[model samples]
Target: MAYVISDDCIACGTCIDECPVGAISEGDKYSINPDMCTECGTCADVCPSEAIHQG
Candidate 1:
């Protein structure tokens, strides 16, 4: 499954650079495009708020 950004996201833009597939997008809470996400977990590793997780 792809990783999902939870409401806990702080929109810090940290996860964007960590996504190797560029699946992350900036927004009020940031979002991960499941179609593009590779489920690499890089974003989750870098998320300061621990908002990204397996979905």
Candidate 2:
């Protein structure tokens, strides 16, 4: 499954740098492109708000 960005996202842009596949997008709350996501879990690891999780 792909990792999802939840409502808890702080829009800190931390996960963007950690996404190897560039699946994350900028917004009030960041989004993850499931199609491009590699489920690497790097984004989740770095999320300050603990927003990223497996979908």
Candidate 3:
């Protein structure tokens, strides 16, 4: 499964750059495109708010 971004995201833009597949996008709370996500967990590891998780 792909990783998902939760509401806990602080919109810090940290995950966007961390994603090797560029699956993350900026928004009110940042979003992860499942179709693009490689489930590498890179974003999750860098998210300070711990918003990204396995789906």
The candidate scoring highest on lDDT is 2
- lDDT-wise, the better of 1 and 2 is 2
The lDDT of each candidate is: 0.90, 0.93, 0.90
Range of the 10 consecutive residues with the lowest summed lDDT in candidate 2: 14-23
lDDT of 2 by residue, 1-55 (tens): 9999889999999999988889999999999999999998999998988988999
In the order shown, what is each candidate's alpha-carbon RMSD? 0.5, 0.5, 0.6
Error of 1 at 40 (Å): 0.5
Q: What lDDT does model 2 reach?
A: 0.93
lDDT of 3: 0.90
Per-residue lDDT for 23 in model 3?
90
Off by over 4 Å in 1: none
Estimate the lDDT of model 1. 0.90
Candidate 2 Cα RMSD (Å): 0.5
lDDT of 1 by residue, 1-55 (tens): 9999999999999988877889988999899899999888999988889988999
Task: Assess candidate 3 and give its TM-score to the true structure.
Answer: 0.95
For TM-score, candidate 2 versus 3, the one ahead is 2
Q: For candidate 1, give the lDDT of residue 33.
A: 95
